[model samples]
Target: MFVKLHFEEWIKNEPGVSENTKELIDEAIICYRAQAYRAAYLFSFLSFQNLLKERMLVASCPPGYDEEYWKGIQSELRNDDKWEAKIIECVERERPAQIFNLSVDTKRQYLYWKDRRNDCAHAKSNKIGVSHVESFWLFFESNLSKFGVGGGKEALLEKLKVFLNPAFTPVDSDPTSIIKEIPLTVDSADYLEVIENVYELTTVDIFGPMKTRVWDEMFKLRGEFLDQLVEFIKTNQSLYTQLLKEDPSKVRFFANDPAFIRSLWYEMKMDFRTYKVIIGLLRHNLIPREELNEMISTVSSNNNDTFFFQVEEPDLLVLEESGFFSEFKTLAFVDMKINDFNWARENRNIIWHLIIRNGFDETIVEALNNTMSNSFIPWRLRDSILELFEEFPKLKEEYIDVNSRINGCLPDKLFNSN
Candidate 1:
């Protein structure tokens, strides 16, 4: 009865129509604009059902509204291709109620809200907007209320709120999918585990306690792992080395390879995947910044394009200048450690200056304690440090004392503990 009255009021508002048929036309217009073709059809079909709900139809009027009247409204608008006739069929077939139905799975509702509904409402299409989305909810809510179903409005509302919020946006693709797609070789997991363990060991308790045995095992494992990886690459591509020179894109056989697992290990520390991918691409003479950007976007769709920081040429140049990239890439082959005070003295200026600059004073201090604590003097890079001391001895002394404090040279609260 309410729907009929509402329908009548809507039609009456249509221009150039008799007051009697005006309500019907207005209802059709609502259906047409909302793209509720199926609902329109059903509304026409169940015109009489409105009487039953209203507890009316005392012999003067038939028990229901005229199905014929609703049908004519639908036929008149059938020529519009934008309005699907089956909308009526769908509404009738589903026969969903207007009120909320908490018993129904919310995940289904959430999925529809997050994917289908959101897509329709926001996608590049003719029909889009908050009102359009709200119309569907209203249709369902009205029908559901008749069946005494209720409460999913909150779920629908939550999704609407998220869609409207500036902080959240849906991603068309996922980048971490690549991480999941990477396949592990038989020893790949073990190899990575060993490398991680060794890396951890290097960071903890100076290399003095178990240095000899640990170093031997680490080097041995590194050698074996490298050999196995190289062999795997060779087997996958006959022209392993040449792949680097010719076309790295063609060598994407490693997309699902064990190297990716190792790459993952490094990636967790500092997004080394792009660098590794870049290195692989350079080897193959195929660089696709666009593709790389897509990968980044897929994984992290913030839309700010901040991952641009990773692809920046200047940052890459700085890393190269600092030798950080070379050091990481060749970690397995090199024996790099602050061996003694003399070594620290030789490398102190540039090394410690970099350490402070990067805000890694604690790390450098820890390293110094383990390696250069015993010696009266330690490494300071060539003549540079000496010149610094001569140029400004007081400042140099302060610098040394501050650095020593960082390295835990004293037991006072003037450093990391403080």
Candidate 2:
């Protein structure tokens, strides 16, 4: 039988999927068909969650994410302040001691990146050197090997197959592949039906053991990393909170606290928030760009020159009130749009290639998910996926089928596909 035909049959026995949720599955499939893996991945995951929530089987959170998961996110946010403090002192405010406290490696990368950024910003007539060309090629080469066109995770697995045991194949596809291939023509039923479906899907599911194992490993690592971060923040909260509470005008205090300064500097170099805040300050006219650079040069010179800004506790309060750091608390998702997912002139054709080649599997699913959240996806903006499923039906049925397969049971078809 054709793969699509098997999918349809599987859907016939799927239990618990609401019609509305089914629609989301269908839409994800359609997105897959249209070669919009980014949209497909996002929508599929959404459909899965909404379905479970409808059944009252799971909370309204992403798969593999729980209350602890959310708490961990909060921990990260608090720690984000340390990095913010560093950027404020070193880059935007040009506090010398802040720059000196940074690790040697960080200082090196920063200097290199800053020079390039400055040249571009000033529109300097800088000569493009051979090294520049080589850097560009190196980046392209690394990405090419990572996610080559028509090559998703499965492809990546194939390349790594040689080192595997007899029972392990690099190209082993996850049973979840079934979920990824849902067409874009189903609609979700009301919340009740959706929840029932999700619970049923979660139990007795069969995405090959190898595939499941790999996915499990990935999630395990992700959870562990998050746990480590949260623990670090909890342990260091006393120091960081104090720094954050201090006045930006009284930057000298940060220099006096040697241990705090060391930890704060390390956090700044690693956290994205510090850089983001610095960028935001420049973008929003909070600080003069030249003045910021001068601060960096000063910090570079002495690494502990804290007399630059006598920042006060009120200054820290002002920043917090401005939404400078606590922006990632809410999830921002929307229905997928072709225009939103496309990049450059060849996107349409690229979509065609991705779609016409047997629908999306795990690799394609990840690619689509990555694309949905690509840096180009915009800030404070989330891509919509729920609506996409409501726009499709056949795809939804396929999603239910996959879930049913995983559960080792028949899938339910709420709507007549005939």
Q: Which candidate number would show the highest TM-score if scored against the true structure?
A: 1
Estimate the TM-score of every prediction: 0.21, 0.15
lDDT of 1 by residue, 16-113 (tens): 12333334445644664567754443333233123112211111111132456434434433444522333223223222322212234532443343
lDDT of each: 0.35, 0.33
- Per residue, candidate 2 scores C-alpha lDDT tens digits across 39-123 of 5544544454343233222111222345575344334334634432332233222222221123455345434534543454455
- Judged by lDDT against the true structure, how good is candidate 2? 0.33
Listed per candidate, the RMSD to the true structure in angstroms reads: 24.8, 36.4
